[model samples]
Target: MSGTTRSGIPLADVYTAADVTAEPAPPGTAPYTRGISPGGYNDRMWVMGQYGGFGSAAETNARFKRLLDQGQTGFSVALDLPTQLGLDSDDPRALGEVGRVGVPIDSLADFETLFDGIPLSQVKQIRTTANSIGPLWVALVTAFAEKRGTDPNDIAIFIQNDVLKEYVARGTQIFPPEAGLRMAADVVEHTAAHLPNWTPMALSSYHIRESGADAAQEVSMTLSNTVAYLDEVVRRGVDIDQFADKLFMFLSAGMDLLEEVAKFRAARTAWSRLLESRYHAGADARALQIFSYTAGSSLTAQSPHTNIVRVTIEALAAVLGGVQTLNTSSYDEALGTPTLESVTLALRTQQVLAEETSLAKVADPLGGSYVVESLTGQILARVEADMDVIAEHGGALRCIESGWFAERLSQQAYEDQQNVESGARRVLGVNCFIDDSTIEVPAFSVDPSAEEQQRKRIAQTRADRDQSEVDVALDEVRRAARHGENCIGSITAAVRVYATVGEIYGVLREVHGPYTAHTGLG
Candidate 1:
């Protein structure tokens, strides 16, 4: 209470109504500060989506079934590094990382195995982190649906396809910035023409926050990046109204209770104003839908049980902030994959908040609070100021391509760590509460044999398919990429022929070339 917010917004003691800049408008109105939905959870509860996936296809399939049985309403796939990078299980580079942190998926055959018994129509949403290979990921899902005699339009899907964020905050980028933007737009264009229920983009601020962005900076970068995508998509002659309303955002729910809540409120305020004023967006597009995963960066390995308390606070802020979908991080995730027990505990946390607290009865539980309102206004102002700086530096894409965004994020990260080391910031088990005590926390481990099984599966897929059909499909994909045609159609064709993810990406690599590191543009 004595210090400023993580983003340097000043904190005051005993806020009064005098501190609030504007009086309240009703929820679901213009400049939507109170909440997006008029009735909020009183009408429909937010979807509880706990993120989990690990090891081989069959192993992860069992985990998905278990999660669905435990009352999870959606899917949040965490792809392994190799899969995230578009590498196959048999690739030499994928040897050590085949199935370490998340699920390994090489082709449609793997998806067939991964969702063997799960019904696609029954799931509310299926979201994954597929930035660089977003177009491929969407095609694979559509192909899998066709294989099972399900219409792709009936199954709601979401892909985290913010490729610009990959260049700055995450390291899985496989294309140049300009080329990546084009690929992301290709998904939007193809989705608009084909799968109407699918959301091809989930603009991400979660990674930016984890990479050391504060609340205000997180809001600024996210909106700035949104502009880049909107410009590209609309440039393709696609009407903004048709697909803009379906766009999703992924943000962080941090540990700071009041500021985190204020951040979400501010994000909603800024986004609504931008869409209405800039793009002439309608009511549906202005009501922003947010998906938050509790700050994974906040979890401490020292006293891992303390993470339960951390996630609870973060998830509470997300609910108060009025998210459409939410996932709570498991306590043991920092140490290893979460055990089933830990995952259930995480899900039950949301159940208690939704069912027992009676917090869902009101639209905006903290709507008119003097402190919340004041903090929300202040955070929005800071976000706008930061956006001005981003514009002055030639916008988000320029900042990322020139390494300006990376430089700023690294600077903030360095300062934050310095504060913790110097005791300016006190973390519960990390800096304070010093003891010689050791904590034992249970975790889930990957089986060593999973890698070999994955390799054999990939080999069998290759041996079983017609090489001539795959060759023709790959050639068509290269043609689409070269001729500036939307590549989703051809990519889906390739996946149907059992062309591996790496093979599809390999074709693009030849056409677009690999990415080279950027030095700051001075």
Candidate 2:
């Protein structure tokens, strides 16, 4: 019944050994066309993470505990928009937004409050959804260790420390690209030197897809950005093997069923080749690709209840695609942040697949399928072609600097919006099956006064802390930035002295200036 993508490439009806351009290697081998790790689910189940953040630190902590109690295997913390943009909670530009989208974190106190009773030592993994607040992560971990009476190096943290993408695409950037990248390098160097096992970078393809790139484009752009980071670190005279092993991948699985599955397979193949051929990385680093949560952008506002079915399909795709970690978006994501009920349902979605579905019993069940193998081959070719185009233009960062990549993405976004508006693309409940009287799903609501309370917290933190210590810390941060020393160490110490996020980022801006993305289409 199925044909091909809208681009009119023929869909291979079935796949065989002859159909795949390269013969499928055994799982855990070079290329990883089958899978990356051996004894896939038997050795480890995909990290099942739940994304939620809202209200006060105490309130969000309660929510975090509740999810963990509900069978969530790991935690993925979400920060408010102000936090994401590196602004203090009380900044005027942050008006009407505190805790509206995610949790409010203004100071180290807030971090402690949010993690009050959570056992950092015993938790499987904790992903801090961060970009601009890379320094905050270091401070938070240090504080957590001091409180637990353990070495901070024992903790695991995967920060979304991909700042260049934030500058060009997400608009969550606070410092200039050069400076922001320097801060990221600090995190990479610090984590590699200290934390050792913790992953410092999760080169995010989630935002790329959210911004309107297709699945193949998403994989290509992410790898291109991965190359950009490797270039930055190699120029710093660090060994790629040491740092690249700690770099992981973050991708999105939307509603495109087969395409999404093939995307993951293609990503594994491309990442291995990129690491081995381009970076001269060995098997240890080439075999490691830490995959994480799929974003909620694919959810539809109309007939929102149908999103459950959609999420289930995406979860299955991620698993069959051989992801090491996976997060299923809440069904009611479009209207608001997930309610506790919605979050539990999302976690249960993964639990059910693990316990009930036969999918977990076998590794790469689709590995030998004629159609799946053929699709994976084509996707790998397309990704390579796209990477070639990026290289011709001088890599991903250069493309972002020249505004070529963003312009292509912007055009794709424009076309997608038009497609939905004109019915050329059908979003199940949104554009295709509409009914005026269809039942409305209840949307999650946040307290309107939450922003005011968050501001009060920010003010209290500043007043209660030693002002001179903050000044000294902030000065040191700027000095580190100027000297090309590891800025994360300085920023980390500064935050412990109650330096507001804005204050630390302001120091970076002072030294390195702010990045201004090219607003005009080229």
Candidate 3:
């Protein structure tokens, strides 16, 4: 039967070698079309990086330890809205939101509490998604490292510090586009010089996809943002090879199984060629390493129990797509923050896929299929065309500032909703199958006292710290910001003195001024 992929690429019924023109490179070779590693999971299985964090520091710490005990190799942190917005939990704007969506962190003390007894050396990696206040998070992490007597260069820390995507899709942005780009570039430069094991920026397409871009638009927009970041950092005088290998990419594994797999393969080859042609990057610098999160938008609230099956299929697609790390969403994601029971099921989903299915035994298992190969070629071509449109608008930043990117994504999202409502697209439990049975899954709730407790702690922390030293360090931060120097060193110094996130951000806001956009960009 003939059909079309989710990105609207037509699929043929059958296939043969005659349909394939250019042969794929062997696994572990340059361009990395077949796969990044020759043995794939046979050499080493992908990291089971589960994204989690909520409530108070102690509660989040307990959750982290539980996941580690359950064979989770890496941990991904989700900071609350206040922390991501560079506000203290006690701020008037942060009152109701503190610890509501994720963990509330106001200073280095909270970072220590969040990590508590977990040895940084043993944890494979700690991935955090913090855009506007990423530098603050990095400083807090560095301070935590110093206190633990661990070398900062020895730990694997990955920060999603891409502010450009914030403008296009997500909305946690603090500074204007230019100032935000400067902040991102400063972190990149600082990490390249000091932290050899840290990936300073994870160019993320996950948020874009969650924002409702189709697969082709997702890849194109992400690559365009990458180009913008590279151009900014290159102008800052850093060599391409020095920080290129340290950069990682994050994408979403949606429910369209074959389309998601093909998108990943196409992304690898396209990124390799872009690096070589545009930046003259070498072999090692051209490798496209990816960490994927299962699409949160695909979950259905109609029958929350069925989300377990959805997560399983999405996780399988990520594995087949050759993702370096995978995160599966909990079954109760559409209902609320995942309960411990749901989180356990999500982690078990990965284990079942890795150990029971035997899918990881070979690299690029579907490499020779005519349908897969054709889909990969089609995705690449469409992505290139969309990228060309971005170039016409003066690149990703320009498209964002002009509202073109946001407008396009909104249009696509509207179209998708209309498709489901009109029965043009079938969303199993949501639109297609009518279910009258009421199956109730337990909902996860944050502590009602969490906000009050967090506020008291912040107040006590401020009263206990040396106020004069905080003033001195904050002055240095303002000086660095005013003088166009890399602010990371100064921020790290301020964090060591126990400067709160809001305090440091206050100085930056005074110096850089708050970003004002008229285009509804964020």
Candidate No. with top lDDT: 3
Error of 3 at 294 (Å): 0.3
Cα lDDT for residue 274, candidate 2: 87
**Rank by lDDT, descending?**
3, 1, 2
What digit string (tens of lDDT, one per residue) describes model 1 on residues 216-279? 8898999999999998888888888889878888889998888888888899888998898889
Q: Return whichever of 2 and 3 wins on lDDT.
A: 3
Between prediction 1 and prediction 2, the one with superior TM-score is 1
Q: Compose the digit string of candidate 2's lDDT tens values, residues 1-522.
A: 356663334666554577767567887887887777766687778888887788878888998888888777778888889888888887888888889878988878898899889876667778877886776677777765776688877766777788877755688887766677767777887777777878788889888888878778888988888877778778888888887877778888766667777778878888889898988998878875656565577688877888899899888888888888788888888888888888898899999999998888787878777677777888888999999998999887778878887888889889989988899877887788786667677777888888888888888998999999999989898888889787777877887788888888778778888778776654
What TM-score does each of the candidates earn?
A: 0.98, 0.96, 0.98
Question: Which sections of candidate 2 miss by over 4 Å?
Answer: 6-9, 12-18
Off by over 4 Å in 3: 520-522
Give stretches of model 1 more than 4 Å off. Answer: 520-522
What's the lDDT for residue 151 in model 1? 93
> Candidate 2 local accuracy as lDDT?
0.80
Worst 10 residues of 3 by lDDT: 513-522
Error of 2 at 34 (Å): 1.4
